[model samples]
Target chain A: MKKRLLYFCKSFKINFDELEIYDKDFIFGVLGVLVEYLSGLLMMFFIYDFVEDINGWSLDQVLFFYGLNLVGYSLWSCFFINTITLPYYIQRGEFDRFLVRPESPLFQIMMDSFDDDSWGELVTGLIILCYSWIRLRIPPIYFLALPIIVVSGCLIYLGISIILSTFSFFTIAQADVANITMEVKEFAKYPLTIYPKVLQIIFTVVFPIGIVAFIPGMVLFRQIPWQLLLVIPLVAIVFFVLSTRVWYLGLKHYGGTGT
Target chain B: MGNEIITVNRLSKQYHVRIITEGNIIKRIFSKKKYKEIDALNDVSFSIQEGQYVGVIGNNGAGKSTLIKLLTGILYPTAGQVSVMGRDPFNDRIKNNRNIGVVFGQKTQLKWDLSPLESYDLLKTIYGIDDETYKENIKKFVGLFEMEDFINNPVRSLSLGQRMKCEIAAAFLHNPSIVFLDEPTIGLDVFSKDSILRFLRSIKEESNVTLILTTHDLEEMNSICDRLIIIDKGRIIEEDTIEHFTERFTCSKSIVFCIEGDIWKDINPIDNEVLIVDNGKVIVSNVRKERVNEIISLMLANNTINDVQIIEPNFTEMVKKRINEGD
Candidate 1:
């Protein structure tokens, strides 16, 4: 694992060095990310202004949920965004290149591409989370639990991505499926109580997008029992293990048919 | 001979492909899932000794790539057993990969956004190559392939020939005992092909790495390979030394003579041996090795010949003939 991390560092450094050669393009990419980040925050503020309270949760609480979602999403994008291209590689028969390498295919895919743009989202998410934490004045215990929640939330999001990426092995037109499932996370930025009951159930159980923010927010608001917070880590582990199994099964079925 | 580096016992691979039927809207909407099983490899078995240069040749869909994939553990076999370096390749893929290198001519394994040198550094960490060995191998390959000019350039910016050179160099950086190249010279220009082939030959002489090359280019096989394995319909039809394989397919030679006059009508044939006369030339084929002098003398005495040439069967022709015979 340590060696794999080192490999990621080495690969990312190389990518950074290459990006450095195109200084203008690098600058544009960074600036574009900042613009998007700012625009997204502005949109969230506008929505909160229109609705002072959503499903009994104040604007500050909703902001905390949004911030937590960004933190989890950004963390996942940092390492796992490259998995979105798994279907393309399979269709092109390029996945065989990974099979011949000594490293795990999952690890190699995670380390193959780095998203520099996600750093902007990450910093913005951190700042918002800190700001909302001070405004809400949650318990000190919640502060201690924040790191664990973030880690668990990242795993859940990554697990969902891996599960969707595994579908590429079965069909070529899986990009839409992944896109729709990812877009569902957008609903998590608000309180789950405001959504329809069916969507709330789907978000809580089937896809579990709420684990990133809604569930953690409920724990912070003391709306749910503290004992239920354990479900976050448990769900993360279960989802991760199941997704990994599906990935391996998909690999076994890969015929490597196309050139 | 050195120890056997690869062994196969009746290996086979079968894939289930979906078959979709064309029909009306209603029928298409309710289309049933239909599958047809196709055998990519069938009971094929062969072994290669360490340090041998072997060439595998077959027509399209003859299981050349399938065999390589099975050996490299990219695809699992439906039946039979394969062992590379005394380990089950599919079951022990991670361990097996540590000692083998593979190159697919149709694909690029290098990171497109990064330079070859940077990619090599990442691979070095993956393979755990020592600092001294990695530096020495990189320097040697860069010098031999003349890649100093573009080694640091992004892979996307390099020409196909330059990228291919870097790809081959990257494969050999770890100095594995076995290397599998599938059409390594495909899409290369004449100059690039010559340089790559020369480098491969030089490596053969300097190292004991076993080379398993699969290509449609019989000229390359003839030039570098010590042994040839011919496959047809997913099975090994012929496996022998280059000399024996060529000898088996070569039955006769042709002799063409440029005749100044129509002298074929004047020459009385011995034992009904016919001479083909066309466009001021006489041609004779299937001449016995010992009868060459007799045939030439008879032609000379009868006709005024301007030029005489003998044509031996080439490797390309032999391969074509072999495939035709199989069909």
Candidate 2:
């Protein structure tokens, strides 16, 4: 595992260093992340101005949920946004480079790119999370658990991305299709209780997009026991492993049976 | 011969494809899936010795790329087996990949924004190459390929030939034993093709790396490859030493008889191809080697001939024509 991590680091370093060559585009990309974050926060503020809360949670609590979404998505975009390009690669038979390499193709694809935009999102997320934490007078020690919770959330997003990207092998899907589930993530930004019961069930049991932040957020908001946080991370880990299996099977379909 | 670097035993690859004959857009959208199985590659068996340079020649859709993919572990064989250095390439992909290299035509593997030098550094880390050997190989490649001028320039800024030189160098940076080059010279200019082929030949002479290249450039094959494998319609029709294949293919020459006057219909029917008139010359193609003298003597006795010529078939055209004929 150490060797594999080293390979990831090395692969990532090359792509990361490309930022220096095109620093202007990198700056604009960072600004794009900020633009996206500010727009989301503004929309949340607009909604909260009309009422105190949608379903028991206050504006500050919703802000926390939004911050968690940004943090998790930012981490995922940093390493795994390149997955959106897979459909085109599969359609053109350009994925050969990944398999011919000595390391895992999944690892290679994720590390082959570094989205500079994610750095801006990460910074903004921590700031909002800290601001909300102080306003709500949550215990300072809870900050210690923030990183783990955010990482778990990131893995869940990564898992979904992998599963969606694998569909390209059979369907010859485009980038829009590969990221189809991401539309649900927009709904996930708010508290899950705000939605209808059917959607809540779908978010929790079917797609599990809510497990990324809402289930864990329950403990942070003091609505659930601290022990529940442990189970959230385990769900992310198990889901990620299962998603990888689906990805490999899709690869077999591509190379073994068809182009 | 040295040890067998790659051995493919009756390997085959089959795929199921859907055929939608619906001409109407709505019908096509709602049409049921109708699948037909195709044998992309079938019962192919061959072996390559260490340090040998082999060329796979074939027309488009002749399964050349499929065979290369199987050997490189990009595709799994449906039947039979393939062993690269005693390891099944598909089942042991990572292990086999560590010992081999591949180059696909018209695809630049270098990072677009990074200089070739920086890309090499990343490859060093990926392959876990020791510092000394990496440095030694880098210096040698730079010097031999004359990449010092653009080694520090970004890959996007370099010419196709310069980029290809770097790409090939990157593939060999780790000193892999077997390198599979799939039409590495495609879309290159004449000078670029010449330069790339020259570098490949020079590299093969210095190292014991087994090079298996698939290309339509017969002149390149004639100059660099020691052996040739001709694949046609999912099967290898011919495999032999370059010298023998040339001799065998050229044995049946095209005999042209330049008559003083027109005698287009004077020749009697023969078991071989009948005489035909082209620009006032009577020619009989596909004439056997031994029967050349006998037929020419008979024709001379029958008609007045000003000149007689035996033209050996062109290697490149003959290969394509033969494969297309088989198709």
Candidate 3:
């Protein structure tokens, strides 16, 4: 356990040093994050200006939904962005380096690089969550449940990213195809009712982005019962485990057929 | 020989490659079911004992990379068994990796943005190398590879030799029992190649680590390797000591002439044995050892010579000739 901890800590240190994101660079990254969040917040406000609510959801509820998305996406992209580069690695046989290393292949791939953009998104997410929490006058029960909610939401996002990127192992495709699937989050950012009926069902059952943070936001808005939140973590676990299993299965295919 | 640290028994790997012969874009896209099976490696077997330095040599697409990948746990064998340190390399990858180091030619294993020191620190953690040992190995490698000047620079910013030295240092930091080098000297300058070969030679006596090198340069075999394992068409053609292999196969001497621009431009095709390389017009003529002076005189009589030397036929050319002669 001690050795594992040592490796984990050192992976992070090496990643940070390699990324070379200095104080100034990090501050600029934060600014970019804020610009994106504010633009998203502005779009929501514009929608609220014309209509009183989106399917009975007020501006505050919309803000909470948006913030939840940013939080989930930040956590997922922070760790799993490198999965998008799977095709490049597989094509060049650079992925073999991960296999020869002592760490698990997935662990090495994720820790190989650090996405500096995520740190700013986390700060922005928390501020929005806190602002919406006070304005909604939500109950204290959610604060205790927030960590669990975030974990499950992040896992769902991470799982989907992995499953989509795993296609690179078999195909000659690159990151663009996997990146297109990420647009499903654009649907999750808004209230489910705001989308077309097909998109609603698809996000709910097919792509399952609805569960990432949007479902829990609905609970706070009283659109769904709190018990539905119980389903989120379970789905996250199953999805995460199955997606991870698929990654290893992809490795099996890659091993059998050299690139 | 000491204990057999690595062994392979009838190991093979098959790849199902998709055949896209149809030129019709729509049909090609739709009818994607065609695949042809190829045996990248077939029924190959070998063993290396402790502290032995072995070189794997072959032409392109002769199952060399497949064998390396299989032994290193990067690829799984389709049939038979491979044991590295008493464990199946693919099945027990993480454990097998603990005692092995790998360096591939022209492959950037170190992170581009990180310095060698930073990369070494990461390896130390990944391999669980003790602090004292890590420091000691780093110092030794720095001295041997002469990487002190560029050790702190980012890998991308360093010269090829500097970067390669760093990569080799990173591989050895953990002091693995065996080190696998795949063309570790390709594209390196003569000075860098000399230094790398010298380092590998010195380390054998001091470290006692098994070395498995896969390469095109047979000349390197003389410098650092003990035995040569020649593979052709996915099979082991020969395995023998350097002396025996040299004595039997190196029958023809090569006269290489570096002549001024387009020296062979108007000259008629003289012999199939002469190979013309582009830059500097390096003309290498493989003939009988007795005809070395004859070839040199012919080359010198026609053009202004930049350099001339008599050398042994390179491994690929020698193997090609030997195969053609049915030897």
Candidate 4:
């Protein structure tokens, strides 16, 4: 694991050096990310301004959930956005290069590229989370668990990304499916109580997007039992293990054809 | 011969390729998967001793790439066994990979945006190379390939030949005991090809690294390889030392003689030898090596010969003749 982390850092440094060659483009990319982040925040504000409470959840509580979702998504983008390129790798016969290496192929793929644009989303999310925390007057004990919660949330995103990208092993045209599935996770920005029972069930058990942010939001609001917080780590582990299995299965079926 | 570095016993690889149809989406999703098995490699077996330079030659779809992939553990074999350094390549890939280097000529393993030096540093970390060994290998390769001009340039900015040099250098940074090069000189210009071939020759002379190269260029093989293996239709059709392989197919030689005047009527053809005269020249075919002097004397005795030339069959011709014989 230490070696893999060191390798990932080396890969990131190489990418950063490459980005330096075109400083203008790098700056423009960061600016575009900031605009996108502000737009998302504006959309959340627009929805909250029209309603006093969404399913008995206040604007402050929902804002916290939104911040949680952004944190998870941005962290995932920073680390694992390269998973989206899995289809291109398979189609172009680039995956064979990974197979020849002595390290884990999955780790290599995850570290292939780093999305620097996610830094904007990460900063915005942190600001929002701090504001919501001050407004809600949450206890200091909960602060200790915030890091754990954020990491677990990112794990859920990582697991889902792995599962989605693994589909490319079977067919190269799986990027659309992966994109749609990822977009669907955006619905988790709101409280799960407002959605239909079926969707809530699916989000809890099938996709687990609700567990990523909504449950943590409930904990912040003091509406759910603190014991329920343990579910975050438990769910994250189960999801990670299951997704890793799927990834290995996909790898086993990789034919490396067309080259 | 040194200890065997690679061994194969009845190795085979078969891919289940799906045949897609322009059917309805529902049918495509619900119907049972349909596949046609294509044998990329049949029951093939060979062994390579350490420090030997072997060249693999085959036509397109002749299983050259598949065999290399199997040996490198990039693809699992469907049957039989492959052992590299006394370990099963597929089952012990990480361990087996420690002693082997692979280069797919059409592919670039270096990061496009980073310099060769950066890529080399990344590999040094991945392969756990000690600083001393890393510095030694990098300095040696950079000097040997004369890559000082572009070693620090981004890989994307480098020409194909330059990038290929870096690629080859990167593969050798770990000082692997065995290396596999698939068409390493493809698409290279004459100068670049000469440089790469020279580099390869130097490596062969200076180190104990075993090399297995696959290429369509028979002349490249003739220059560097001590042994040759020819595959056709997913089977190993021929394998032998380069000298023996060339000797077995060179059954006849052509001798051409230039004459000052027309000698067609004076020169009589010998039995079991073909003789033709065209435009003040006498052409002799199917002449044995030992009979060259006798034939030359016969021609000189009858007609004045100005110039004489002898042409031996080249590697390409020998390969063509061998494949045709198999067919």
DockQ of each: 0.50, 0.51, 0.50, 0.48
- Per-residue lDDT, model 3, residue B187, is 86
Writing each residue's lDDT as its tens digit, candidate 4 over B1-327 gives 579989999998887788786689999988887889999899999999999999999999899999998898877888899999999877787888778888999999998888899989998888889999999988889888999999998899999999899889888889899999999999999888888888889888889999999999999899999899999989999999998887776657788999897644454556667987789877888776677778777777877778999878888999988877773
lDDT of 1: 0.82
For lDDT, candidate 3 versus 4, the one ahead is 4
The deviation in Å at residue B313 for candidate 1 is: 1.2
lDDT string for model 3 (B215-271, tens) is: 888777766788888788888877788767665666566666677776453333345
**Candidate 3 clashes between residue pairs 3 or more apart in a chain or in different chains:** none
lDDT by residue (A137-256, candidate 3, tens digit) is: 889878877887787878877777788778887886454556754686677777787788888888777667786667777687666878888888888888888988998898888887
> Tens digits of per-residue lDDT for model 4 on A1-259?
7777788888888878867887778788878978887887788779878888877888888888878777877888788877777888877878888877787778788888888877777887888888888898878888878887788877888888888888888875545455654585577777888899998998789778688777777766757887788898889889978998999788777744433
CAPRI quality of model 2: medium
Q: Please report, in order, the local distance difference test score of every candidate based on alpha carbons.
A: 0.82, 0.82, 0.79, 0.83
Q: What is the lDDT of residue B145 in candidate 4?
A: 90
The best candidate by lDDT is: 4
The residue pairs found clashing in candidate 2 are none
Model 2 vs truth, CA RMSD: 4.9
After superposing candidate 4, which stretches have Cα over 4 Å from the reference? A172-174, A223-227, A255-259, B20-34, B257-272, B277-282, B289-307
